[model samples]
Target: MSTFGDIFGAMRQVILTQARLDQLDVRMTRMAGDIDGLADGISLLRDRISRLEGIIEGAAMAASRQQRRIEE
Candidate 1:
């Protein structure tokens, strides 16, 4: 009878452990998706910043050209 009880207890523990693992898997999957979305957002931000930098460089060049003409 004692052996039977031990076996049943072990089975119960295993079931609980399996359930926890499954829950963890679901959470990990969701976290991965969230990370992917964040990466995409960061990429978009980087692209916009690059575009802005280009625009600023162009403006600076124009200003310099204008200044040189004025000096002439």
Candidate 2:
């Protein structure tokens, strides 16, 4: 048989556990948003890097042509 004090103590623990779970849910939501922002940032960086690679490839080709002409 449970005493009143014992039941109250169990209820208190349950409330505290629920509160902690709610806090974790909020933090997880925020972390998900942050991850989405990071993904967007990474996508932008990938696009910029691809453009830079194209520019570098064009410059290399131009340099190679000039070298060939010089060697002729």
Q: CA shift at 64, candidate 2, in angstroms?
A: 0.2
Q: Which candidate has the highest TM-score of all? A: 2
- Give the count of colliding residue pairs in each prediction: 0, 0
True-structure RMSD, every candidate = 1.0, 1.5
Q: What is the C-alpha lDDT profile of model 2 across 1-72, one tens digit per residue? A: 579889999999999999999999999999999999999999999999999999999999999999999999
Model 2 off-target regions past 4 Å? none
> CA lDDT of 53 in candidate 2?
100
TM-scores of the models, in the order given: 0.92, 0.94
- Best by the lDDT measure: 1
